[model samples]
Target: MILVQYMTKSSITELTSNNKKNKVVIHLSSSTKLGHYRASCLILFAFSCVSSDCFGELMEDLTVLSPKAIAMANAVTADPPGIDSIHFNPAGLMQFEGDTLELKLATFDLKNRYSTGPQQVDPTVKASYENLTQSPYPQDPYANQQGATSEPVLLIPGGSTETVPFPIVPLGGAATRNAQHQMVFASAVYSPMMVGFSRPDDDLGRYQGNETAISRITYFSPSFGFQVGDSLALGLGINFSYQGLALRMENRAPQASAAILGGLLSGVSGQQIGPGPYDDVATLNIAAEDYLSVGFNLGLLWSPLPWFTLGLAYRSAAKSNLEGDFSMRYSHSMQELSTELRPIFPKMEGVEFERGEVKMEFTTPQHMSLGTSIMVTTKFKLNVDVQKSFYSEWDKFTFDFDQPLDYLVFASLLDSDGQDESLTLQRNYKNALSWSIAAGYQWDKSLLLRAGYQRRNSNIPGNALDLIIPISDADFYGVGFAYSTSEDSHIDLGLGYLVSRYNIDYGQSNNANSDAPLDLIYNPYAYLPIRASTRAFLLSVSYRKPF
Candidate 1:
């Protein structure tokens, strides 16, 4: 006799048949099956939602271009700055005495670590699955009722830590022709906002994103500055900007579970079956062609006394309409699943493999700064600066696709309305503020020393936190020096370190797809607790030559 049992939320039943002497007993738990099935479905939901968009922290114009400024933690706003003043404080260009060229190179080494609490599960759901029973029937009628309950599970076998390195280069030249008026002309090229990160393919956070590389904001500025009087100067520049981006992410698809189920059923029926019907991996890659945009910068410098100076600078946001190619590919396992299931489930074939045009609009955000430099002694000076970034302007991102994806499988399992040709992710970033202070001592006519510190606040909220850009409030410390090789040439070297950490504790109950079927999937275990720590070192060098 063979007994087959199917348990539902309402009742449990067993079917007995008299066919052969040998007996086979199979038990199925409704809750356990549903949990595993929902887990697989969540993968599909996440993949479809992020396939067409690029994900990362918004770019801030916080790059340090001048080795001297960086050594001073960027408090050079009111100092007699160099050609890098094109970004720090254009009015400082007016102080240059002759034709001067400056070139700078910097390296960034960053280390990041992520940790999470145990996986949380719903407390109400009593049992998931119980040990298999070999007997035809349980000795006690209630024996079958004993089942395992859901509990916290660690997605990542172990917390992960990674370190990455990046290089930065900036070039600029400034010339002052009229000694009396101190009229200056300057031009420079530099990266204002650049970010890149990559994670292992098997990272548990792969669903959010695996790799993000963006050069999306580079600046080419040409400017003019003039001394208005012995006490003040003014400067202005037109910024020609360029933007580019590339993003990649991976997700588990519904076919993975479907294939496993098919394999299990085939085994029961005494039929030969392959490993599985679905592939467990799906990847999305998007690259945008470089685009051009424009913005402007204005600055003012005031000297009330020979030993003190005040400076103000403002840079407008860069805006652009970007177009690019969107491509997606599934693992071979997925193709195998499609072939194996086509006869039974034709609709599952040829899904999620497509290529088309993608478009989106983006903005870089504006920056403003105010600073002062005070000569404290014959050979010593103190510099301080406060800056503001209008990150609030970046509230959300929208991506439009030429063709919509067939998210039918997701719709059915997650009980969704269907798929759309466009998707939007909420950023809801807040404005950020930063301040720096530094002191420089002129040891002699040929040597100088500098030291400084800075503090910056994070702009992202917990709900928007992800692996691609795990940003947090940070503190920076720096030290540097300058050596003059001749009357017209000098070299500058600077080193800096930054440290930050943040914790996120929130419920995913209000996420984009957290309704209806999806709601059931998250229910009692939507809360996630995660912690991230970051450390970075910056090394920079610059050379200046005046003809």
Candidate 2:
């Protein structure tokens, strides 16, 4: 029988129990011991934020906040976009002379693709794998040739991983500039980082990440702006957010150690380790949330010439220690192996289903954006922006389990500093630079047309790429139209499409290939080249009026 304990410390509830085995977290503080704040229905509804887990792999410009911004491909650092300027360039808030309210809605149609080539491995390892799975009494014939799955999956907080339907996300904010017109104040709600995905229990991609992995990062900002000089504007914003992460994935030991064990088992007493080293031996499901994530934004705008405007914005970094529940189940094969090893290895502990509190630390890298807008003519303007992210702060993720883990015990053989109560995933991401250009045409007194293109660079090194978080350098194209509904009210409509692709050679990705001995949970297609493609379609609609 398995036991589990649920803890709620956010004043909504509280508890303590020893049920089974549980593990979690990169952050554990008084908050970890204090409790969880049962979120409202709204929080649950918004959990379906985006599928691009931004914790460390932040795609800073999903820029999903404003219709005008999206339509201009997020090249708004110099021109700003309604209340959403709190993120692009707070200084732009000064442009509003009185109280104004804006509403926005966005939708994403995301699709992913995967393909595999011939296996590329040392001849000896290949022989061992083929012998154990192909020439054996029981075999997985399709093991050598895996197919592709375009279906998308999502993590259901209180439930298991499941397929997701079309999702439309609602986002917007309100802001006002006092009568003095020298100062401006505004607030808005938005999503800066988020992503999630899932695969069938049998999908080959499951080997890299099975089930569903999710991340929720949202922001509510209150900002202030000052017209320092006729041509200079400054702004400051305090951003508070709710950050949560939930994940469910299968685990395996696909290194040479497991293949060797498989070969030995095939010739010996026949105690099944698995069909091969590539099979699943354990599964982990964890979920946690941090209601209070804090950060800030600073911005400046300068118009040195009537036709040229320059702007700069800086976004601060944040750290969150999420608290949540976790459950891990060890397979019967693993249990059997534990039982057999107990005689000689008296220190080994037999493991079963475990449930307990867990903690994980997450970080949002600091970043800066600079841009310029030039009015080529009274009716035409061009905007260009450059952005830099210090993703080097995201070196690794540390998951702290409430109890010792058997997998960690066995993992120690391959790793020199393995700890039974913790596991660290090394990302080794690099700093990235991205840029965009946009043009706007005032065709009529009440009609404006805008078009833009953006280049998004990849932060994941070539060796760290994987299907679960399959990101590559990408291109974003956008077009938008703004129409004046009345003198004080206007309507904006935008459409955007983004495309990215990756072609990883056999054993190129350290995260999913068998070329690395440290590859613990992945390597189902160790020797096979991989191809991945992603296409995202976005639509935004907005209406604004003075209040």
Candidate 3:
């Protein structure tokens, strides 16, 4: 049976005394659970504040450009259409004349699945606790043959090299194991004289449980444009954005199998580890208030020839002031535990505790894009865009501790060495620049075909450091079609597919008998090959009387 203990300590010293198995006391003073809570908050704060989006493989596949623009580009020449092309190549918008405007709406069905191999677990740490409990001792046991020393055979249940004791996930909560899927989109465009807007709602933590989260990355903007001359166009835009976040945490235990525990322990020999309250659940509710912010975009589109167009766009960065309410729901049994569980399943003695709220703000990065498109022939055209992410803008997250026992609490868990550090989490984000190239062919004035490729690198830390961002390389393939039904009526269709694969090396930070703590040794595990594919079909009819 998996057992979890929650306790409050007077100081880091109190934690060390009862830590028999020396489960790296999370933070240092409080139980590992609390330390994780603080750490997760700190990390999210770091990501939100830093221009971190640029570093991941996810950034390579999707851009701020709307789906309609991507679809149109894929359907014909990557020429700009609608104002959306301003972010890719504003020059496409220069093709519009008279009182012309285009309105398009789209949805992005985003799904993310994750899995890791047990080999990534630490064998020499508390994570290896299960090895001690396997049943059916090795036959002709090495122990019986005196003086003949050989490497001891360690058998764990179900072939798991080590079992995680308690919970010391350095990558936030187990909730990450839960799959996340959602849909969000924006549709807006303008002419040389008028503008309009429509933005779909964003769901944060939709995939990680119903946690409250302000989508720090959500964006909404409206824009206006004017023609400078036959070859040049200028546009200005205003951005209004909002962010809110809520993290829902449920009390959870390690994913230890009963068979593994049964075989590891000598005291509970031959006893079946039955399912019990160890699998119960409790909830932690975290709510961050919504914050409003503003920014702007400036763009220019140029077309020196009918076959070639170039564009540039810039967006400003803004900060959010966030505040929130935090509370936890406790299961009856969890509330009764007076001692904390260490790595070795040892119990800490005489601990007490209380819970409360956490608050902070996260920064979203600023970005710029330069794009170009060329109609190589009457039937074929190529388009390219290069963009830069301002990750340096994100730096640190700070918090205030006003509780009576805050000092003792912080010291024991987060800063055991008495560094007297403020509640600040540190991180560095690498600024990233990425590019995309696409090509399309026209079979007739009424028929078109397209195909494209894209690639991006990852931003995960080295094999030695453990961080939560699971960035990796990504590759893409896309095709689209457009059919003209009549001189004034038409239908359009497009599809895009993206694939991401990773051979990551992750370590379990929970090993025993070593300064390294328990670490899941490095091994390769393939998460779900992320797939971002889209299918879109559009129908429209229009008329223009001679003006």
Candidate 4:
């Protein structure tokens, strides 16, 4: 049998017995005499908040990947397209009458700033039993006397700023043969969506999330386009994708408080040790191995008149089952406490609390796009595109652990019934629509100039505002120029700017005071109000050649 025990101050023992076949056990000890149970509970509460909160956004497909497409805010659906049509509108591939090759490169300079209001002390410290009595001499003298107290609120002093640079390269090729009766075949390797960021350990939002690294989500698409007459064409493609991710964050435990506890443990073990200044923080790191998934895309191109063209495309959602390992590491202080307590707690000694396997289910949202192009004259053209992202499918994110993390003091206090724990974060995301419009002028056949504007709506609700991605509705403005280098070769260059901002205020209710510890932690940022904003600049270049 597996036995777990909780010793209360009244010399009462609460015993929880389980089958020995179970691999994990949890124990909680509270000394009522010294009023240490309250301290332990507070510590556990912080742990509960840290263990449950995880955040990220699905914003990859929203980014325009082609130089010319981005130059016009991705309004290329109805325009005569090149290799990039594999992603924007494969049916446009029919415009290519011969073998074609294209290479595109893009860079993003992104900046984010976040600020929070001043921190506030926990309200419990201000509570006093003396309020119940008016007597000059109270039963507890120290009850109402408050000179100095513990500051549980962790603050970054000021705010924080993060700057990151990202680079992307996309390659594509297409071929047409007369023997196939006006059919075009194309293949491309590109990233439809990719997002990542990292911050320092001392960042103000460290408790929320410090780093998110998604190396790549590469798509290998092979497509076919058929010309059914001169006015309309159809295309279909299969998209194979590979994805990888690594997420890391610091837990909310104050190292100073943990070190003090460790010193007390050392004294109980008949050792002369004091709390160390360096031993007070903990971090949890999770990394997912690369995984593969598949999806499909379809496109249609129709020109009803000599001066007007319409295009439609749909990209299916891809679901990925990410498997990885999670590891928890403590400061020197926690390691010492675990060492001393292991002897009295034999069950804890058998379990490896440092590492465990984790599984996460993620889905890339689907997209539907419609576009139209009008030729005002031979030298001037106008284009408009509308897109809808089905983000309602991403309602929540859950991470499942293969083994229990009993080493966390709060895990034992909050939920001790199971050896495997599942952590779920509610997203409640909603579907969003985005649109773009652009105009292009052909300055002779050798030069073309384009400009456009776009707006993307936020999928995250105000109640679910997150610190990791800090997503918000954004506006994009762009300009570009395409130059013909030779009879069969051309180069396109584009520049764009994106801007967004959000206000965040999660209330101040402490979880330690909750009726049920398992309930979600609320008002985690009650002490501080947040203002988050993002600014990014995009530069892109593409080279296309006919062979």
Best-fitting candidate, measured by TM-score?
Answer: 2
475 in model 4: Cα distance from truth in Å?
A: 0.9
Off by over 4 Å in 3: 1-65, 72-78, 86-93, 119-220, 250-283, 289-291, 330-358, 399-408, 411-422, 459-471, 483-492, 508-547
RMSD of 2: 11.2
Flag the better candidate by TM-score, 2 or 3.
2
Best-to-worst ranking by TM-score:
2, 4, 1, 3
After TM-score superposition, what is the CA distance of residue 357 in candidate 2 from its true location, in Å? 2.9
lDDT of model 3, residue 344: 31
What lDDT tens digits, residue by residue, belong to model 3 across residues 1-547? 2223333532222222244443342222121223222222223332332222222224322433233334433222235444354333333443433233333333232223333233222332222232333333211111111111111111121211221222111100000010122111122322110000111112211112332112333244445555666677665666565444444333322222222222222134344332111232234444454436565666676779999877777666755565555444444433332122223333222122334544465555676777777889989978787767666565545644334222223233534432222355444545666666777688898776655655443333233121112234445555555566655333444455555544323332211001222111211111111111212121221122111
Residue 354 displacement (Å), model 1: 2.2
Per-residue C-alpha lDDT of model 1 across residues 323-372, encoded as one tens digit per residue: 77755665665455445544433344545475677667777678899999
Q: What TM-score number comes out for model 4?
A: 0.73
Give one digit per residue, the lDDT tens place, for model 2 in 78-115.
Answer: 99988888878889999887889988877665566677
Question: lDDT-based ranking, best first?
Answer: 2, 4, 1, 3
Please report the TM-score between candidate 2 and the true structure: 0.83
**Cα-based lDDT for every prediction:** 0.56, 0.64, 0.37, 0.57
Residue 331 of model 2 has an lDDT of 71
Q: lDDT, candidate 3, residue 176?
A: 9
Better of 3 and 4 by TM-score: 4
By lDDT, the better pick of 2 and 4 is: 2
**Where's the lowest-lDDT run of ten residues in candidate 2?**
33-42
Local lDDT at 29 for model 2 = 14
lDDT of 2 at 432: 90
